[model samples]
Target: MVSLPEELQAREAAARQRVEELQAEAAELAVRLERARAALSRLEITRETVMEVLADLSAAEVEAHDAPDPRETPAPHGIGVMAVPPWREGLVAGVLPDVYRDIVEIVADAPGPLQAKQIVPRIGLEATTAKIEGTRGKLKRLVERGWLDEDTPGRFTLARHEGDAGHVNSR
Candidate 1:
């Protein structure tokens, strides 16, 4: 080692202090770098797990939501229950079959059960097995709902007269 004067000794001490400050700064930077790497890893894992969970939940929803309406039950009568079609014809004379519209028209003009067979031609409902039976099924529902009453075995007309409408209560 070369001999140094008193003035040079002070400069050498300052150089050692500067080296210590740089060492401390490097240590702090190393700690920050490790924390940043750990945070990045945690975010990657969280993103992958979230994607997997969403995929499973989507699959479950598809399985559960696909189903038919339970209210569409089979009609008790030989004919099946059909939807009450939207009424667009003039005068709200109650729910009547499209084919049986004429039958209702005739009855509204002159009230009575124009027999099942007689109603076919007038209402344009040809006396086919499916058509007749479906109409009969519809008649049964209307009767149950108090919109039609079986005056005789096969003869079904309107629910009841306005005066007797109160007596037509479901048992």
Candidate 2:
């Protein structure tokens, strides 16, 4: 049989090899995680763009028709997914007040959830506490209107189908 000292050294070598393997695996996983995050960010932007286009088209259709079409429904949040809120299904700018429109735009462009104070700089508004509070209120209203989703108590992000107006009826 092998000596005890030799056996301990052999076990140590095996343990070291296992550790190296684990380290390599962890590195690979980290790379994959980063790639996934990038892809998700790109996809979110694409979704927002598509929703905006759809909303503009729907608004044009609504203007041309001069009558609400019963056949069309609000554009879905995703591929064949559930419908978004009615306000987001058309030209939000046409419907919402100017301040609300600015709020939506600011939140939509944010990379992640944004607090009201952070929004003031991006939207070119005053940075007073009252202004921040007002921003918070407006953000909350947008959430109520289905234009945004509150990621946390005081932070918000754009909803997936934010600007999606469902299919427009052909004239």
Candidate 3:
């Protein structure tokens, strides 16, 4: 026959052991939860970085698609031989590319003839040698296409036709 006090002591020891086991399990579960949270944070960062890179790539593709290739061969009949088309009576500056249109507008609005260095800054470009040279090339192309004139060397102005007035308007 077991005594009542002895039975009570035995039950108390079992309960203490169960409590210790439960506490150990809880500590291990907490570590696992922290590790999972850290992994989720890392994954979120990686996903955001990938999305940014993809967006940049998409923008670059659009720009490349919109920009005309300078080295492309001309089609028959001189239809597509040049990027800067020859100016006609009804032709407007809007027919040109974004950079070309901006250049024409700047030249048209200038009080006097402009040089490549003078035009570069007005077109929101940095005043670097490469930028100046590129602008010079565009200016020469415009001159050749009859959109502009080079009355003096390295100076550009809007071309004047016999009956075409207000050909280039500010937009």
Return the lDDT, model 1, position 42: 100
Q: RMSD in angstroms, candidate 1?
A: 25.9
**Winner by lDDT:** 3
Candidate 3 residues 9-124, lDDT tens each?
A: 99999999999999999999999999999999999998898778756754674567454442342212332224565675556777677788899999988999999999999999
Task: Rank the candidate models, highest lDDT first.
Answer: 3, 2, 1
User: Which of candidates 1 and 2 reaches a greater lDDT?
Assistant: 2
Off by over 4 Å in 1: 1-103, 163-171
Q: Count the backbone clashes (under 3 Å) in each candidate.
A: 0, 1, 0
Query: lDDT of each prediction vs. the true structure?
Result: 0.55, 0.69, 0.81
Candidate 2 CA-lDDT value: 0.69
Q: Model 1, 114-143: lDDT tens per residue? A: 455655555567788777776677666655
Pairwise lDDT winner, candidates 2 and 3 = 3
* Candidate rank order under TM-score: 3, 2, 1
In TM-score terms, which candidate is top? 3
Is 2 or 3 the stronger prediction by TM-score? 3
Model 3 weakest lDDT span, ten residues long = 72-81
What would the TM-score be for candidate 3 when compared with the true structure?
0.52
